[model samples]
Target: MRVPTLQTSRQTLDAISTRQAEQARLQNRIASGLRVQSPGDDPAAAAQAELARSRLAHIAQDQRATQLAASVLTTADGALAQGTDLLQAARETLVAAGNGGYNLVDRQALALQLRNTREQLLKLANSGDGAGGYVFGGQGSPVAPLTGTMTPTYDPAAGTQRVGENADYEATVDGEAVFMNIPQGNGVFATSSAPANTGTGWIGAGSVVDAARLTGHDYAVTIGGTAAAPTYTVTDTTAGTAVASNVTFSDGAVIEIDGQRVQIHGKPAPGDSFGLAPAGRQSVFATLDQAIALLEGNPTNAAYNQGLERVHASLDRALDGVVLARAHVGEALRGVDAGSASNQQETLSVTTRRSGLEDLDLAEAISQLQNSQVATEAALRTYASTARKSLFDLLG
Candidate 1:
């Protein structure tokens, strides 16, 4: 075979260029501390590195979510703790009021304290969870979980005041389990009966029951025993005429004057009357309304005292709600921690796998670089020697 002189020189130069390029690339990798600087260098390695980087980013994002969740839970826990203290204080006031030595004046003083404690509790219930939402309001935003005004009515036949929970977080806990599981009040007022009325004639009526009083009325009203023959005595005070007749109440039941509502189970006072359906969902306020009425009225009465006892029991029930809520918070915290740990582990594993697929072996890279350096040097030396010896020297 005839060898072309120019072709030999061209091939030597090409080989030297390729070796020098490889050496330069290895030096760049070392300087940058990264295996794959460009896709052109190693397309497969670059793709693998991108995948690892994406996984790391997701892991970091999940960690932030976990931290945020922890903060929310901590805030919720603190609010619940404050609520528990307020409830305890309210119970102490109730017990003090129960003491025989407390006169009506003393009872009135106790009522003031009760009102203060209740206000504190309302603040706690409406506490923000540090995330622009009420901790107790489930998913609702920017509104308090518990809210309403309270008014005093001198109705004798009412029940004691009690606090109840409303809007509970349902995402991590059962709403009913946390807010609707309050214990039944004393047997004095059957869950199905209208509370006994006080001997004092109805003091007066209002245009609108205050929000709190109305809420209490909602829980206080109940259906009593089997319906009796309905009847009505209409004394026309203005007309000065007494008329007696049988007034048929629905379901053969007459409304009793229990002071809560004018439902079929009970009749409103001369001036009092039932209004439209409740403004909001039934809640602790409703329960408390019934309880406060029961407590203030003749405490000496058995039914009244029974209602009071029930109110105390309700305190325990409310506490149970807090405990249940805390349990859910705890569970959520555990889940968040577990998820963060899982993400961390996965990130580490992916990083290792990606390193294996994309990262250069420093020893191998260093050795290859040295070899390329040597080959380029050899090529340079050969080129210089061949260029010096011309075609005449070759022929000789």
Candidate 2:
């Protein structure tokens, strides 16, 4: 078959142009150190590289989240440590106050020390995590977990209120556990009780009762019996008469039978009596408060000494709560560390895969560029020499 002369020249020029374009592309890849600069260069490789890069980005984001979570938990743990110390100091102060020999002046001095401890505890409770939010307040931003005076009133109950996410991450601490779990005074009674009026000479009655002597055994007490303003009366079964003795009231009021003063509450009636015994919830704070009052020369009355014992018991419970909180913080810190490590590993893996798919091998790329350049040069030379030679020239 005879070749077309015109087509031959055109074909040579087209071949040279294609070779030059390829050489330029290869050179660019070598300079940039990228095998797949565009999807046109290697469609399958480009797709794989994109997927790997996306996975790496996600891993990085996860690592950041883990870091922030760890920071917040660490702040909380530090605050709890301070709280534990304050609680311990308060326990010791209460023990000192329970000593019977301390006079009114000595007791008042002890109350001042207790008040200082309470202030420190409040500061700890209100501690913040670098970010303007309280550590113990959970997800409730900007609100302190505990504040103001602690009081007891059944109707107007008060205590730490939870206001945050219930997820394990948010529930890293329990505010109520830290502030309200004191021995004998954890109930609504402690929260809602009215303050003692000094002028009225009445001190607040804590739920706990002090140990005292009883005149009648296996007897009953009735308050406000038979009269319009009837009240409690103690009856002696052996004597078959009203003893009117050895009964005490929670408010430091006493009654007299023979020469001995007995505690009584309200108005007394015939055959109405209550068994004398120690009573109160086991609480750490209540015990401390009682000790403070006793040290301040405030009458703990019959219930004061019993309150000191409860304070000691409450301390153990509070310490346990603090330990649990610390453990939770430690666990969260571990989890954060683990998550960060996982994210770093995942990121490294994704980056490696991405580099394999998208990065150019410099040695191979340089060889390809040289080969393409030689092909382009050879095509240009061939096209220039052959296109200029006509059929007549060939015959000559």
TM-score winner among the candidates?
Answer: 2
Worst lDDT 10-window in candidate 2 = 191-200
| Model 2 lDDT per residue over 1-396, tens place | 223377777887788888878888877887888989999878999999999987777776666667656777788788878777877776677667667788778768878988787667667766776776666664354566555556421211232222112222332355555556543332212211013211222212233222244332333333433434344455554556775633333434654332223333333333333332222343234545655655655543434443444444555566667777778778877877777777778888888888899899999878877888888788788767765676677677
lDDT of 2: 0.57
> What lDDT score goes with residue 390 in model 1?
57
TM-score of 2: 0.65
